[model samples]
Target: MARKVIESVTCDACSKKGLEVPGTVNLTVMGDRYDLCDEHGARFRDQLAAALAPAVDAALSA
Candidate 1:
């Protein structure tokens, strides 16, 4: 049995296209989950970190 994906979003970091397919990072918010590719997932995480707080920007180099 396989779990169905809820939604698919493009990688905000890389322009690569992705689908709501399996084998990807999943994040559930408000009873909904978004599927992101590996590269984009990292980017999404970074964006989320930055959005959550300001410390993320200070941790960046240059």
Candidate 2:
């Protein structure tokens, strides 16, 4: 088993301060973890939704 390092300080995506601090969440994707602020986290969520929206629409239409 590989060791999991818990370095929850800065946002891995944007290097924003106060990552994984109080009242924050830790995001993990494809075995990679990320610590993002509220701003970046909302952006990520919107992006993911947008990415899936087209596919979902297509599937529904078909």
Candidate 3:
């Protein structure tokens, strides 16, 4: 059993004063978590989808 921890995170894609959007997007890659704002979150989602599309298509075709 492993213990889970949750902490506040600032958006990694933006660098502006008071621009931190907490509790927005929590993305986990290879066991590491990243928090992003709405804009960056959407971009990340789209990029992830595009990256996975090829593998998904191949899997479906097989």
Candidate 4:
């Protein structure tokens, strides 16, 4: 078996970065494969959610 590599991406929220621990997700979000570290993931998710809400709402409305 091949060893799995955990890819890390810079946090989208604070931009205060950390090493990305490995995990699984249904789809990659905001160009990152997994959530950011505790310092920024929450803020990143919130910002992403807010930024995407209008688009999502429009899609849903349509």
Candidate 5:
């Protein structure tokens, strides 16, 4: 018989229960791992992209 390992994770932004599946996005920022649900993960991704857009544009222009 084989044993299964389950990893329980919760969303860092909203503290909501996460799906805890292979497709879940686990983000490590500043040496801390944050688990996020689909909604919060999307929001975080969008915000991060928006924040980095200016720097990316500046670097490209330079």
Candidate 6:
């Protein structure tokens, strides 16, 4: 068996990151791709949900 060496991966949000890709999420938005750490990814998702909440409520009411 042989081990392969790969480049170091860092959390897009972590300082002096020890984590790497294949571990982080690859999120694509508006034709742009971004690699984000777990915390950032969850934050983004929360923000998106919050931003859309008003619209969602309006649509539901209508």
Alpha-carbon TM-score of each model against the true structure: 0.47, 0.58, 0.70, 0.45, 0.69, 0.59
For residues 1-62, write the lDDT of model 1, one tens digit per residue: 99998764553323334333343666667997766668667777887877966665566743
Candidates' RMSD to native: 8.2, 6.6, 6.9, 6.3, 3.7, 4.1
Preferred candidate (TM-score higher): 4 or 6:
6
Ranking by lDDT: 3, 5, 6, 2, 1, 4
Q: What local distance difference test score does each model get?
A: 0.61, 0.70, 0.81, 0.57, 0.75, 0.72
Over 4 Å off in model 4, which ranges? 1-35
Compute the lDDT of residue 21 as modeled in candidate 4.
Answer: 45
- Which whole-number lDDT from 0 to 100 does residue 32 have in model 2? 84
Candidate 3, residue 22: CA error in Å?
3.7
Give the TM-score ranking, best first: 3, 5, 6, 2, 1, 4
- By TM-score, how accurate is candidate 3? 0.70
Residues 1-62, candidate 2: write the lDDT tens digits.
89988754655556544234332547888998877667678888899999999999999999
Error of 1 at 6 (Å): 17
Best by lDDT: 3
Encode model 6's per-residue lDDT on 1-62: one tens digit a residue: 99999876555655446544332766677998767777778888799899999999999999
Off by over 4 Å in 2: 1-8, 16-23
Write the residue-wise lDDT of candidate 5 on 1-62 in tens digits. 99999976666666534334333577788999887777777888999999999999999999
What's the lDDT for candidate 2?
Answer: 0.70
- The list of candidate 3 runs beyond 4 A from truth reads 1-8, 15-19
Candidate 3 vs 4: which has more TM-score: 3
